[model samples]
Target: MFGIDVRTARVVWTAALVLLGLYCIYTMRTTLLVMLFGVFFSYLVYPLFTLAQRACGLRVPRTLVLLVVFAAVASIIGLVGLLFGNQIVAEATNLGQQLPKLLQPGELERRLPLPAPLEPLRVRLGILLQHLLEGGTAQALPVVRGLGTSLFHAAGNLIYVVVVPIFSFLMILEAPWIESFLASLAQRPDGRLWSNVARGLNDVLSQYVRALALLVLATLVSYSVTLGLLGVPFTLLLAGLAAVLEIIPVFGPLIAALTIIAVAVFSGYGHVWWLVLFFAAYRIFQDYILNPWLMSEGVNVPAILVVFGLLAGDELAGVPGIFLSVPVIAALRMFAVQVRLHRAARLNAGGAAQG
Candidate 1:
């Protein structure tokens, strides 16, 4: 047996405990992801609930306001589902049916020009394509099987959904208590520093969420209008995809537009020029107008920093990382600023007294 001193044994035990904790978290990653999303959702919607409280006057309790807020969200979801359900379903089905044709070797090769020197690569690609087409059923069977597996995985998650709202509501309801607890943990007796940090976080988070919502809406509207005007089939589905992709910040909208444009090209749409125009116009609008205005209003995060944060988040945590990274970075920035200012002030006063 290896000889170990008490301190070494304790350190080893602590490291083992830390590793065990990490393993446990990795196992429960999905639930933790959902919970984090739920928390952010609550943060985003808190202002609306507060506004509802004000609109109701002091007569109605805050609990009632939360209920109203929940109902409003649920109603909106239901209304959208009711209004667009058939169109969405039809467009999704149409897109699925057209996907194979769209992916044909001739269609892809037509779209992408290959260099003459890359003939060998092209030949290999052609062989791969032929193999894919010939063994399409074999290749697709696993994917089809995966759909059933995914459905089974998702089907009985009602309890999780129910728990999310409950947790969100509690987080919102206990917001004041949470603040009090954090305040108590502050280094300074006055607690002003922590209070400032808390307020800054709230303000930044609120603005960022609002800006994201507006950007998503703008993207959805612009994409839907353009695709509809171009007579693109599956317009609803593509527009919805654009809206969802809008959540990813810089690269998302471009990907959505390119995907839609590709679909247009493959569908034998006569006015591909119009589709190109739409994408160009939307890109201009987003770059010149919406993004600058929305981001400026949301947080004072530099564009470069936002991109860096996005890359880092994606590297660290994939999609969830991207979603959570922005606000977390902004909050950290605010805290850092507060700390620097406080330290500078204290140092200046001490220097003046010494002089």
Candidate 2:
């Protein structure tokens, strides 16, 4: 189109395809983001599907198998929610009650260790807090009002919980058809290119999901045990928080630890040292042993790259980006590898014929 010959037309078309991809990403950003989450959740629950199929002797219909898995997952979530609903509500209420006091500058400083140099900073913080309580209240009034609005909106998340199962069921049932459709779109449908791409995607996603599941389980067990021993209120809620944060990669565990520490400190726990020790131990264990082992087994994405992806995703798509960035990058990486391999195979075949 830009004064290009027939051969150059192909190059231009490829560029156009790239630009079209970028445009699609821009346009379907939210839908694609939600679908990516669906895919991840699908991957996470896939093992349960496989197990169910095997348990049913693999003769049961795939649809039935999916339904069984979906039911099992729903039951578990419902049961847990029912069982811990009161405790979670109580803990949340207690945390809410303590938040104002906890946010006081001197309160945290008095309970937790602070650096010697930060004493002067603490005084400044007190003054700042005083000013905030006075002049900043009016300025912050909008934020308070916005939070109320957000709370109303957040109540709709139950709809998402209902929607997820439906999405997962459709994806599982039609997964094969979806793959076939994608393959049909490729330039050479029968080429090894698509096979390699599919294999790479499967391997990366499955491994990542498995490793992540194990890490989550480990975090839940570790945190639950520690909190139980330390006699922390809301053990289940805190452990659940740890498990959720464990999805964030390296930084997740640190945030979880800090959150646990903060909650424990504010809850007026008698043995804060035990809480601190619990956090420190888990942090060390996760960094030194758990993460290394899991990353080596799973996606092999570099820590720095992961951090950058998280930051970029958070900026672009908020929490969804943080959760999906690694898997999305892994998928893209798989695609690139397939393309490169296809080109290399063609070049090798050409050289072999000449030789």
Candidate 3:
């Protein structure tokens, strides 16, 4: 009104809106994370939903199919918990009880005998290890506490657990409606590029999520069997930890190996040397063969790019960022491809018009 140019005002308004939206995101990041995870899990659930519907020849109602699929997944989780949950808990409790004793001064030296050549340095070695462990644990306390708080909050919030599933269920059922809404906003006059991008992202996400689940299961089984056969203490506990951490890619298995070997050495396992060799071999097999085969269809990002993404993601958002970096990079790559296709189509149409 006060001599503002119309175009300038419009630009100002758009910028303001973007800033407001960013503020909202910052304020509600926790809710957004939950929603994001719900969307991720919906991709996981939808394929099973589709598969079950196909198995039933589409005779069953979609809602019924979804319910049965969810029920089966829940039942399998519950059954696994029933089978191994108590022992894992027992092992965790035992670890808590034993950790203080393990940290006692000279305990490392007493428990770990030096080779004859290094026998004189046993006390120094123990002292160095004790100082390092205490220092590291002290430095790590805040992160560990934050993680524990997050887990406790997730477990304690009944609504969150229910809400996440409800989101997945609604997403599956109302997918068409959601698509239409997004289309209304996203579709452009000159091209259907947005739709194509969405589809590519969907395919990448679905395949990545399913493949990741399979990888985790394989790690759990392989580690459990190998550790149990090797008579390693806390086989189930360590295996479960490895499986959970396996989602983080490159650093996950390394941490698991170091932790497992440290536990073996501290617990006086005789075959610690054998465990080291086995882990080294297994890491090679998993990284070079198993990971590539599983992720080939979905994510084609190079190993160097993946490592860089992990570092960038870790800097930006810590562990969750590291876990999501590959998929995010894949989606971005897909977006770039769609843009190139759109540009080429425009060029071809322009040439045709000139002809």
Candidate 4:
């Protein structure tokens, strides 16, 4: 009775520690999320750091490489701001001024031309709009303002903006040490089964992240250049916003499209039809051509699983979680497959021994 089974005790201890750790994580999830974003940002920029390091004959430390990369990115952003910052600020101010008028009960009636046959429908819409403006708008305005404020607040969070970069830098600087430790773990008897699993996860996640970043960057550049050429108001802001939203799954693109179309319509942009056609064509091109070339081959996650994962992630942690969901699901699948293979091998070995 006093003697505990070795395996049972081990399992009990492990389970207790895991549960405790999970509880801690649940409580501190917001902090963990900021760190995770730092990790993601590091992953995206890592290849550039590696390239710069190699170009310096590997004498340049990763820390220096990271700093240089960050500086370069900052310079580019600053230059762009210098070029178009005033335009963006002016457009944003104009939009802000216009929003209240647009939300007025009669504003829609004035802007939108309804057919005589739809007069009743128009009247109903006016009533609905009046309700929204009179009662709901007060509530809605805070929510909208909160949404924007929360986004920038997260970015401006002292811990996020400062500590995250430090964490990212440490992670980058100590990556080799981390890999060595993981490799050492793999040498342990219990870890043999997971050695390949670790390596496979690294490969899969690295490739997926790099590809995804490239896709986002390509989309941003395409949107900015094309929209500018087409004389879209707030080209930089809209394109940048679209690129950020593109990181989210299904609903993101739709929201961006609707927002842009609404602006075009209300602003009396005569090229609204052209804008629609261009967006339609670009959507087709991206879905059929660009996505296949970049992502459709490598990840190969089932459509249903992808949808479910996105929904679950969105439910869990909003947009950032949505961004994390795919690679995480893919990694879990790889682990499951590895475990199944290992279990099969053990069973086969047992059968052979019996024979």
How do the predictions measure up, each by TM-score?
0.75, 0.79, 0.89, 0.82
Model 2 agreement with the true structure over 1-355: per-residue lDDT tens digits: 5775988889999999999999999999756656666766788788788788888985788888888788889899889889878887887787778778876767755555446887767666565655655566678788788777867876865576556666767888887897786667464635567766776787888778778888899988888887887798778788989999998977887888877776776566667777777777777887788867876433777778889889998888767779878987877877887798789888999899999
Please give the TM-score that candidate 4 achieves against the real structure. Answer: 0.82
Clashes of each: 0, 0, 0, 0
Model 3 per-residue lDDT tens digits across residues 1-355:
5998999999999999999999999899778877878888898888788788899986788888889999998898899999999999999888778878877866788877567999898898899999899899999999999999988877787687778888898889998786786687466754478777887898888878888898899999999999999999999999999999898877888898899888777777878878888888888888889878877544778778789999999897777789889999989988998899888988998999999
In model 4, pairs of residues that clash are: none
User: C-alpha displacement of 192 in model 2, angstroms?
Assistant: 1.7
Candidate 1, run of 10 with poorest lDDT? 106-115
Best by TM-score: 3
TM-score: which is higher, 1 or 2? 2
Stretches of candidate 1 above 4 Å error?
1-31, 105-156, 179-187, 190-193, 296-308, 352-355
User: How does each model score on lDDT?
Assistant: 0.78, 0.77, 0.85, 0.77
- How much does each candidate deviate from the true structure in C-alpha RMSD? 5.7, 4.4, 2.7, 3.6
Among all candidates shown, the one with the greatest lDDT: 3
* Clashing residue pairs found in predicted model 2: none
The deviation in Å at residue 151 for candidate 3 is: 3.6
